[model samples]
Target chain A: MPETFDSPPRFDTVLIANRGEIATRIQKACRELGLKTVVVYSEADRQAPYGKTADSALCIGPSSAAKSYLNKDALLLAARLTGAGAIHPGYGFLSENAAFADAVEKAGLAFIGPSASSIEAMGDKISAKRAMIAAGVPCVPGPDTALSDDPAAVERLALEIGYPVIIKAAGGGGGRGMRVVPEAGLLQEAVALTREEARQAFGSPSLYMEKFLQHPRHIEIQVLCDTHGNAVWLGHRDCSMQRRHQKVVEEAPAPGISPDVIRPVGRACVEACRQIGYQGVGTFEFLYEDGAFYFIEMNTRLQVEHPVTEMTSGIDIVQAQIKVAQGDPLELAQADVKCEGHAFECRINAENPDTFLPSAGVITSLALPEGMGIRVDTHIHAGYKVPPYYDSLIAKLIVHAPTRAEAMARMREALAGTRVDGISTNIPFLRALFEDSAFTRGETDIHYLEQWLKQRRAP
Target chain B: MSAIDFSDPATIAFLTEALTAAGASGLEISWPGGRLRIVIATGNEAGVDVSVTPRPAPTAQPLVVVKAPMAGHFYPGSPSRQAATDRLPSVLAADILGFLRVGPLLLPLCAGRAGILTKQLAEPDALVGFGDPLFEIEPQS
Candidate 1:
């Protein structure tokens, strides 16, 4: 039965259960939709500028993340106290937590994301891979089952898949609790170690193995789905500039890849979202190698790199996610989706440009670039204290132009003009990176940043 | 013949320095019912004088704070109840000074010590997190 507009659940106020730039971003979206926003914060973020602008701001807990941002009970209590009818988890923290989503729904509030069941299904690597394969989304060659405890069977499976297999925890993501076995001799130890780590970390010892690609680009397809079963892919992003498994920079339309190659992948992502009954915004991460796409996992939340796709597709993804949460059907069909121009997003992190250690202090002075086709999403200003307790990403500097070269040039100009005083930033490193010949050429693999850093460090 | 600890040069020096830093002419601190006074001379070449006396009777105890044990809406009493003034009633250590209403569960706010509830710190029904002060208690004998 289709949900009619009159019968659909509607909410007037949204409690933003996250912090930093995403909180500011969500608040903007809510205000534009004529919905009131309640910004909840930890003690450390009591003075956050967004809090002052929100309809209602409350301190939920102390400075520690576990007691504040990650506290499910505290978040629910805040939502109830503020009279908010819906919650926008933003990203990170409890955004991907299935139990929290279920709790919010049980509390008679809308969780502005996918249903808990979809999150649970995709949270497990084994089940997620099976679902992708069943949906005709390309996946790495491996059995969609946990590795057996029998050492001989594990070795046989590894041998069948060829050497250089990766044993990953079924319950782990974000590049943790995984091990790579370059040869047969190290397979058992790697599995045992990863299994033990997984059990301790994710409370699951179930492990799976897959063929580890040596040189694959990190390309991801962004999709938006509604409760009415409509889904569309909003182009693709190449977040191949990474350091320590974290993306430093991202660009849309993945330079050098023709639309013919990525069109099928995008369609498959949309199909997968529809098959799983997924709703709201999500990303289907893939490893691109040898002109083929292999599904890695699906992030059932708004990604940090979503702005790049938003710039190219000219879509307000956050607002779309909110509308879908309100039981509204997608306003645009697949045929209406058009990705134009080239866009780049540089994650400005508060860290030492050399050592990459977090630098937390007051932003004594600030200057950000402003021009046509440039957007800066940030929750900071002069005198805003960068708290050390949270993620180091202080802002996202995005630029879009008619061509990739122009976008790169604009980014270089933006980086040069950007200045954050009283703390170290990765601005200098980013400036140098934008000038690199290889990066300007595009199509760098996921390991390019680390190798480049190493080359720079060598005497 | 005074019971002052003249044997410990460090104690006398510390007292002398504290008195000089505070810009007080003299200070008399008593222990075991005996008082020792250090007086500073006005001249550039300052001098000190020590004397002893008997101590006086003790005074009243200090005030204590009643804090919220958890985060929730604070209620001074039941919804139907009313108070004549903002002042809170005297409370026992285990008395229910207020309640932290967390989703239909009201956890009692205990004074945790005997005292006169002199002031209500938080507004009634205000959302407060853990450790927020709800009432100020003047400890009684």
Candidate 2:
């Protein structure tokens, strides 16, 4: 048995400040750990099935997310009322909010995530890049500092980086607050426009520039750290299948890259996590191009695409995060970490396949596939009402196999067996993408999905 | 069981008051001695008149539900007055019905309309979220 730390703060109950499938997922993990769970819901989700299974459930507010899920005080109050010793922010909403994490800690309840300072450090794009560079991690060729006010210096910096460069806000992520200038002529104007937009949006006008990789793939490394300084990277995932800068599909082992090629980057990520004293689970997002990986940003919370990594590594990441929060040391070292099989996750969104418009209504009928190598994570069921106020993602369909090809085949079969009625979904589009020759061949960039959709629309 | 004395006016008046207090329209007690029927008038005119037949259902009085303005631990009344529920408090539109303790802040919950607070819907010291009903009031006729 691994040596245990002496008398760390242990929590017996956890309050999940999230909704939908993730809430159900966290409750399951808490139950397995012999911990009680308190599930909070908005009026829109009062009928959510997960609420019935929790140790206790509370209605935090009305249908608006701002008045409910995103309300920090409401979540804290709910935690206090339910006698929960910890709060689990399951991605999205307040998951990445540093102030919320700090407030949770201040309230004397474990935040079940990294320290607030760590979140702040990683939230800023420039500071995160600097930390990555300091840890000897590969990053895009650019100075690890924000752009100066002088237009001439900005122009010179862009020229030095190369013809095509991207100016990004220091406080931005999720593909927002960025402008790519292909040549020097548009550099100053792009910088000015982005600066103004950044000021209005992110509360800061600071900007940075980087050499743009025209055809880079979005790859991410999942890392788990404990309070005892031990950290390990589970594996890498390819999330290049996206639309409107939102990932739609993800697969683990990031096909075609060998362990030898990725091990160095993974090691650097672990080093970076230790350097910054990051705890719990985080994802190091990188852009891979021409056999080289460049660090982009790090998500300081569990990711929506975490299931792919979980399937490939055979690790329950949610449980691991909770254990780490309980002040447990790493049970396994980097050498013990193994990436076993390939896995793919398709985000089942409640939206029109053609127009991508959200479809929210009662699910009149439903059927999910269940067999070897197939898993469905969802809180939706027959007669479950899909609220129009939140995210469109209703479920995640994951499949795993010994090889990528087999995983793909299993996913196709699973998708075929799945059925949902009374609401439009992107299942048809996903089925078509699975049959695409290029996607089946395994390598596609972030822009491939949008281009593929456009081509399909052409007469 | 002994048969009820339906011929007694005292028994009939007692039954009429019971139906009025329970918010029911009418009640009929048929014993072997005789049948006793009572009906109450169905309007804002507040008096129970004993009659021999069922009258129309009572008109519903408008009610004002004092809801929580924010999420916090609910106190039925101020710290000095802890037994607010023991006696129904008559309140004006701006009367303080309770307080919502959120962290260091204590937000006052108003009655929002003039009425007799007929019920305390939320338990004292229970956590209440925004718009959760705390008190139900029947507006004065």
Candidate 3:
């Protein structure tokens, strides 16, 4: 199998097939590369700031995401109408969709991500675990195969993996379609419910069982690869500050973890990328528990938390992904890469702070901190209306400093300086979280945030 | 090849199923025998809203205007009806005035009501969105 393409990709204009901050982010990257940008928007996002800033923006469909962003034909037609040479599925939506990538390539347009085959391989959890194990990356204690229909066999496998096993849908991601069984008594019912839920949710009943680490922290290795088989693991991120499996805060260099400990795991991730013939940017998500890394899944797209790694590594990941899409070999080798400083990112969601219900309306007043190592990636401004039809993420607040404690202090200052009015934001919640002694100290597990919230709510 | 009898209820149901399977909003097939326009209003479900625009959203502009029923490339005149463009401002009959070239199929744009096409809002061969204003009509005095 060929790993590299010798010639440059024949494309001048890049179409961003996403909305909000990511779309704005992709446009900035394309502009830096001297490429024209075509942004497609749904009717709800007609007033979105990113659309106006792009070289060309077209309304593809109505307010619904189905009729617009997820509408493959509409997106393709929008690209054709605007004479776009390539499509960048920034994140979510069709970013991890294999068929969309294949269709874009088959339509003679470059898909600014990895190949469809790679996405397919990693999209399925069982196949991804197998690939990771083959590449010497650590995996959880379980078989790297789909569960069979035999109920007795399923129970035996659960017993083998031990109690408190997690049954995950092979096709599920973003923390959906899974159930944790505490003991053998509830195994069958858990499997049946998860199987039915998986079929209804991810359109696949195929599932895999694994030992559910009770207190594992979410660790991700950011990797960038090119068509020439060159790949580099930028650094590690500790996204342990999560609520309901949704990461609310992220930081680079992952607190007290030693380089000697993470270096091999990073290399393993890079090796997995090479084995899969991956191109563009991807994240190898893992669960860190008991001083070991367990491969969970690979996100074949630029992540929302990519900026923290960029700040630490002194690299422009979005631009690098775009250049790789242009058939450009990775300019920086593994040795050339250096991750310094510590960075933290807080997702500013447009939701009620206490209740966390989505609060979408016009931002009548707004204020954000601006200074050294303080960067805010947001599409909303004063008077910008937040739509109810999409993700609640309104902005990403990132800060960097020489040390983890300094970065925490900077984030504290950044959160204090940040303000949004006329609609609710999670700034209050984030401010409270930053003040928490355990999070400030770092190395908190994934379950820490929920526990803290529970403690706070307790009378 | 024999033209498909789209009027058949079984055929419509089958096509509807195919559309659902393909995750398409609707299907419009025109053959020598008949024409079928199936618009599936996927309500409260995970599907696109393929609501067939039977006519344009009438504006206060008392003049009846012609609008696109769906998305396609706008061509001012048809290959068989070249004289249609020349008859601008002419009291056209309830017939084909222009055509929306949707790939190989050219769906006819009907005046639906006899009126004078005062202005062509869209340029020839311009890729237009669904329900986009195509032609403005002025009723006869």
Candidate 4:
């Protein structure tokens, strides 16, 4: 076992346990905070540029994520061997994995994220909704109780919630294990089909029901909390531009919505975190329709689009998360948080822009935009190989400006300046989206991206 | 690069056979960085000869590749600072060499067959996804 860093030991080094852009992003945060970083890589990512810049780098495992990033034992051992005091699971893989967090904490090293229990609770959609309701947070019209096997009770409950309800699995998230019931007659059949699918997909036949909003916009509130019971919401972002539930673009201070409209929701989310003693950075996702926000699932980890909120609020969220993990108090209060500008983030993925198929190969040449209000979070460079084994996301091009229009304009300029060769990317699609009138006016819903893509691809 | 279809049993089986025949003592291939060789062994056990018969690299052309057996972070030394026995300079094949820690317990990260070169892949502690590289070795004459 590695020696524990007790007695108020100052942590000067962090071991990043994931790969790609998030790894580079976390390393930058650590460097800004004057901390050294230790990076690990798989065989497939041997030429990653981020490894070259790290204070120390090592080969952990093979290209498969299961043996590399997901190997909890290996990560702890690295921290033990390198004298690293903390492990930052940037996102995906083991970021929200409760067991990994528990193991890290048991090894006497800080897990730079939420507590294991919080992760467990929020990882399950039903449990999270229950917790949110318990803390007086508004949830969608869904019963807190699990669905019964009785078809009659299921039909009765669906009637009470009204028609056009959605049947969802308790263990489901990311829009899986769900089926929409259009009317009263379809409720029972939907329930049965969803139960079977949920059982097959989530390993649980248990499910819940909710009113399926046809054109709801996706909005989310980012929250930060310390171990000292202090928690605050760090503005909001609109992630309505999605394809099949996966967010394609996100912007902060969701355009056109007044602070009054979102203030109560944000407060409720913060209160929920405090009530549950939640720690680290988290996101409360919601569906906004009919001018009211309906609570959805909570993500108990740093979100991918966190850069947008960071740009708008000018807060180093990753640094704050690390500080919180090190048992530090919240330095800035809710009142101290002053969101100054609008920000937008476009996820640049290596894929077929038309079919959205992943495109993997070595980057022959690359150029990223520089200057004020423009930030590129990525690990790719000229000659860096984009391995086909993992996610297609290659970079996140984010911009901040005094106004939404200015931010949009800056994104246009930044996108034009950026160039990545030897692999197909979504840059062209994003550039075209920026020119769309609906997108410019912020008058689009969750289905807008898919619909736009459909129209563009139609013969 | 072509995507290795891991879902197909044939890929895994072929890889297992190819790895065994590579006779590179041990080889470490990493994503982000590419490949590394750490020759910790001497004689026939220490290397893999790609040009000739699929036999391990002979000492006359000392070159051993230390490939990762699984995916995880790779460590090259022991916890205590006695500075573990060096793998370079081609020690006897029976010599006890460096280690790789998975989490708590230390797993002996061997140089199995021997050689002289000690090239490393992945970093000292970066998160190496599966099949990442660790070391490469070129045997001594």
- Tens-digit lDDT track of model 2 for A1-459: 122333345899999999999999999999999999999999999899999999888888899999999999889888887789999999999999999999998898998888888898899999999999999899999999999999889888888889799999999999999999998888889999999999999999989999999999999999999988899999999999999999999999898888899999999999998888888999999999999999999999999999999998889999999999999888899988888889999999999999999999999999999999899999999999999999999999999999999999999999999888999999999999999989999889989999999999999
State the interface C-alpha RMSD of candidate 2: 1.9
Q: What is the TM-score of chain A in candidate 3?
A: 0.98
CA-based DockQ, model 1 = 0.28
Q: lDDT tens string, model 1, A1-459?
A: 122222235899999999999999999999999999999888899889999999988788889999999999988988888899999999999999999999998899999998888899999999999989988999998899999999999999999999899999999998998898999988888988999999999999999999999999999999999987889999999998999999999999899899999999899989888888888899999999999999999999999989989899999999999999999889999999999999999999999999999999999999999999999999999999999999999999999999999999999999999999999999999999999999999999999999999999999
What candidate 3 gets wrong by more than 4 Å, as runs, is: A1-8, B1-127, B130-132, B135-141
lDDT, candidate 4, A1-459, per-residue tens: 112223223477899998999999999999998989988777787778888899877666778888777888767766776778888999888998999998888877788888888898888888888889988888999798799898888888888998789999998888899998998887788888999998999888889988889998999999998887889999999999998888899999898889998999999999999877788899999999988888889988889999999998889999999888878889999999999899999999999887889999989999999989999999888988899999899999999999999999999999999999999998999999999989999948899988998999899
lDDT of 3 at A450: 92
Q: TM-score of each candidate?
A: 0.86, 0.85, 0.84, 0.81
Interface C-alpha RMSD per candidate, 1 decimal: 1.9, 1.9, 2.4, 5.5
Counted clashes in each candidate structure: 0, 0, 0, 81
Worst 10 residues of 2 chain A by lDDT: A1-10
* Ordered list by lDDT, greatest first: 2, 1, 3, 4
Q: Report how far off residue B81 is in candidate 3 (Å).
A: 8.1
Off by over 4 Å in 1: A1-8, B1-67, B77-96, B112-119, B130-133, B136-141
lDDT of 4 at A357: 93
DockQ of 2: 0.30
- Chain B, per-candidate TM-score: 0.54, 0.54, 0.50, 0.43
